[model samples]
Target: MPVIRVEMFKGRTVDQKRQLVKELTDAFIRTCGGTPESVQIVITDVAKEDWGGAGILMSDKYPDKK
Candidate 1:
């Protein structure tokens, strides 16, 4: 089984997530030679306040992004 984990800032629509998983599964199967049924993916959505970079919280770093 191939387990894939993805973490990104939240706010993506459901359709976008669906497309992401489908494309990811297809790419994994094409390159890694795994069946779609055997592929597992986990998506984690983090808020800007919960994620930090450059010694500053993302919320503060990119307030305009919110």
Candidate 2:
């Protein structure tokens, strides 16, 4: 089994996540010779305030975000 972990800032819709998993599974199977069912994916969502970059929090970095 191939295990994939994806970490990103939160806010994607369910449909987007569904598509991401499907495409990832397909790619993995095609490249690694494994069944889709044998692939495992874990998505971790981090809040803007909880993640930082360039010595600044994402929430603060993008304070003007809509």
Candidate 3:
């Protein structure tokens, strides 16, 4: 069994996440020789405020411009 975990900033649509998992499953099966049924994927959506880079929170670094 292969378990894949992806963590990223939130805001992706459901369709995008669906496609991403499907493609990831396919790639894992192709290269790792595992069945789709045996593949597991976990997606974690992190808030910008909770994520940081260069000693700055993502929320502060990339504020919503409106």
Candidate 4:
């Protein structure tokens, strides 16, 4: 079995997440010859506020200034 974890900032559509999971699973199946049932995909969507750099949240780290 192969486990693939994807971590990224939040705000993606359901379709986008679905595509990502499908493609990742497909890759594992193609290269590792693993079945979809044997492949585990975990997607973690971290909020921008949970990420920080230099005392600023990623939500605050730009000109848009969320």
Q: Give the winner by lDDT.
A: 3
Better of 1 and 2 by lDDT: 1
lDDT (CA) for every model shown? 0.92, 0.91, 0.94, 0.85
- In angstroms, give how far residue 20 of model 3 lies from its true place: 0.4
Candidate 2 residue lDDT tens string, 1-66: 789999988889999999999999999989888798999999999888998999999999876466
Model 2, runs deviating above 4 Å: none
- After best superposition, candidate 2 residue 38: deviation in angstroms? 0.7
Consecutive 10-residue window with the lowest summed lDDT within model 4 = 57-66
Q: Local error of candidate 3 at 13, Å?
A: 0.7
User: What stretches of model 1 exceed 4 Å from their correct place?
Assistant: 64-66
Q: Compose the digit string of candidate 1's lDDT tens values, residues 1-66.
A: 889999989989999999999999999999989689999999999999999988999988778532
lDDT of 3 by residue, 1-66 (tens): 778999998999999999999999999999989689999999999999999899999999989779
lDDT-wise, the better of 1 and 3 is 3
Model 1: lDDT to the true structure: 0.92
CA shift at 33, candidate 4, in angstroms? 1.4
What is candidate 4's lDDT per residue for 20-48, written digit by digit as tens?
99999888888889579998988999988
lDDT for residue 24 in candidate 4, whole number 0-100: 91
Residue 37 deviation, candidate 3, in Å?
0.5
Candidate 4, position 25, lDDT: 89
